[model samples]
Target: MTISKRTLIIYLVSLGAFILAVFYFIKTNELRRALKLSEENRDSIIYALNQRSKKMSELDSLLLTGDYNSALKGYKDQLASSDSSSFDLIQQRIELTKKFIQQSRRVVNVDSVNQDTISMDTLAENTRRPTAEEIRNYDSLSFALRKYQIQLDRLKSQLQKKSYGEYLTFSSKKGNSVHYVGQVQNGKANGHGIALLNTGSRYEGEWKDNLRHGEGKFYWPDGEYYIGEYKDDLRSGVGTYYWPNGEKFVGEWQNDQRSGQGTFYNEKGEIVAKGVWKKDELVRVEEK
Candidate 1:
């Protein structure tokens, strides 16, 4: 049978309209997806920018406060994570921090050395012989004086570096506070540095894994001090312990105790004892 012209024309027009609708729907969906993806990318970029800005602001604050250690750490972290374009700037910041730290250390070292020399001179000048009571109570008096000196030294150090405090302060597990100025690695005191304990004690020397290792000088608040070697935080190897009254012990040590061959001198610089030692006691006296 022959189809009507009107019917054929209507059917073709209807089919074209349906095809157009399907094409429009597909294109619209694709456009919506592209727009969503672009929005997500934009948000990510903004978040990253905000984070970078925050980090930079924190670094600036650390530098301004003279917290060089923290500032250096922050810069290093940034350098590790940043792109090549920022490498030069970050590296420069790291170098500047390092120089500042080195200069500060030099100043501290000179001041400490001068103070130590002066103290030694004063001790040398006191040539008065000890009385009966002074000799009998020398041990107790020396310990008390050393304790007092620790407090005094801590105060002095604080006053001297008030403006440019170039140290890191932290508290120990036992609620004691410690102020450290020096090289740090893996968040622990390492390399050369100085540590001031709240107990009126000070240590200046090499460290490893937060422990006193290698050579170092330890001072009490009083005029007593020790120059020695250490391992695992214990006094080891050769060392000298000096008292304010001009007495000194030079000897080998193990586990913080006097051991092996050693010499003990009186305030008059006379040798009181010279021999092998065990746990700080002279075991065998050698003829001088």
Candidate 2:
């Protein structure tokens, strides 16, 4: 079969077009697969965020009802199961949810319950409790408690507003006198406010019923800042503390002090020392 030049050219052109078509088809399929995978990941991220938010809501309700055990379980599960490297939005959602759950947990007072019950019963059955002045005093106390409760409710509402993600709260006390402020919700400095030390230092952050809870930032007049988790007005969990002497410590802190593994950095933000600190002192240090 002797092919003419014109026929040869036509065949070559057809073969080239056929190859281009096949290549285009494969490329389009690959692009479609990639897009599908991306969409799936996006949906997964959304689902995870939604689940975490819902858990947080449930946690709030549990906390309001004083169901700490269940709430704590949920909180721990959320923290453990969260994908920390997800998008910023997802990470924030998870962080805030965990914060709410952990913060709302009321400090259990094992001794106060029995003491309060006994005191209340004794007060109620006082044989000489018929004085008008005494009754008035009791009434005044009741009124004050109600007022406090109302204020607490309003503060919780403010926290809910802040938790929606658009506000920060801070408190300050001036002078040599010490004044306690309180813990806040949704990162607003709210709840039972207490000044820890009178030495011109302040810690402000998440608060629940006037106790420090969740992530808190504490600042001292001596040019120190501690940023990390807190429980019951104390630094507990991972945190970074900046000292006045141009040094910093970053590590897992507990009970308003450095406890566990940490790194002490020099003024240049270089890790000059690494060690386990207990009670704010280096128990062990490894120079690297």
Candidate 3:
């Protein structure tokens, strides 16, 4: 078979064009795959960062509430679940919490001793009168207690500052101090956040227009705490209130008072009153 020169040249050109087209298509597909993989990796990294921030916030809440054991546990869990190299902050916090726990224990022990000594002195006074030596000893113990209390208070202040240092601080001439950290809109707290007061009180949860308008937890300096709904900066819904002495109230609230169906438990955890309450008083007792 004899072919023309022009015809042979045309066939070769077409074959070359087809091969180049196929190569271009393969490379384009590979490029698309790589881009998709890169996007996936970027999304994952963002998610991980968000999760870490949330965990750190939780730890901060625990610390502010003086829940050392819980804070320690949370830090440990985070460290265990994450790569240690990336969690140096968590490691440092764990150590800080341990020191705080030890200091708190010492304060508690001193307080216990003070209480025992007072009881003994009271009994002796009732029998007769405290001797000169006894009076001097009592004075010494009282002084010691005062010193220890001051130390504890200072430590608490330091802890609060460290935890809230990165937040916005507000101070007033009337000795009111508040530190807030979280979402802000229009120069006001508008979302989830934490607030700590100079009086050793703290609030963590939702905020609307700088008022506690949703669910939240409030902790007092004396170890009392409340967990429940909030409206307009007041306890306006169902909630649980716990006292330092082991008393508890679980029920409804209005304007920060117990104004609805609720149960009040004494220090022994026994229900002292279960009924309708009004203005912090049990108005009607419900038979159990």
Candidate 4:
């Protein structure tokens, strides 16, 4: 039996509605994911801002009351306990802390305040005068400020490089033996980071799509270390290899072997061999 024109039209409309519904569902999921990530980033930034604001208030109180020892002790404890990954969202909060600190410093550094035909220089100077404990506290605060500033600078560098992306740490399971910690993007270690292997060999540095790429340092379980450029997970390009037995090689490498020019040094820090090599074997020695 042939369907009537109206019936066929109704069936087509129903199929089209079904397709539209599926499209809307997929788009809505994507939007939800984006919103979730945005919310997380916002929360992290807000948390950092709150913590810094609290610290700023405490610093002001300490300075006003000359409670330098307590301030210094608390600052040190916080730094010691801070997690490395805690700064992953630092870029969002750096400006807030910097501005607050700058304003606080200015307020603290005022030399005098004018009041009712009297200059309050004496009182201001006395209040601002640094005691020994205050000096120590200021020193530690300065150091901590510099440290966080440096971290922000590194993050800025990473943003420029875009090699690691924003996320930190990429983990995998191929059993119970392997683990990784470092910069990750797109669910893989795509930036600078470290990986631990079951054999006790650990590699740290730049990565691309989960492979060791760019500059990296690999430490063998036997105490040997390879510091150099890597391509596709093999030591390539310029690098230095150090042996626990006091042997070292510095030079060009290709295809996981020494090639082109290189210098060999013994434990005495003296160059033992300088020359060309092929496939991990010395091909020619340079005339010293």
Candidate number achieving the greatest TM-score relative to the actual structure: 3
| 52-145 per-residue lDDT for model 2 (tens digits) | 5566567645633446566657656655654432233233434443443344332230011111111122212212213455445445544554
Q: Tens digit of lDDT per residue, candidate 1, span 196-283? A: 6776566778888777899998877665889999988888999999998999999999998999999999999899999999998989
Clashing pairs in 3: none
lDDT of all predictions:
0.66, 0.54, 0.67, 0.58
Predicted candidate 4 versus true structure: per-residue lDDT over 22-135, tens digit per residue = 444444444444444444444564455456546634643442243444544554554454445434333312322233233334223001212223222322211122345544
What are the runs in model 3 whose C-alpha is more than 4 Å off?
1-166, 171-175
TM-score of 2: 0.34
lDDT of 2 at 4: 100
Q: Name the weakest run of 10 consecutive residues (lDDT summed) in model 3.
A: 109-118
- TM for every model, in the order presented, reads 0.43, 0.34, 0.48, 0.44
Off by over 4 Å in 1: 1-166, 170-176
What value does the lDDT take at residue 56 in candidate 4?
Answer: 38
Per-residue lDDT over 14-129 for candidate 3, one digit per residue giving the tens place of the 0 to 100 score: 65554444434443444444444444444554455556666767787787677889999988988787554335546666766675575456334112221111111221111222
Model 3 root mean square deviation, Cα atoms: 32.4
What lDDT does candidate 3 reach at residue 53? 63
10 residues in a row with least lDDT, candidate 1: 109-118
Relative to the true structure, candidate 3 reaches a TM of 0.48
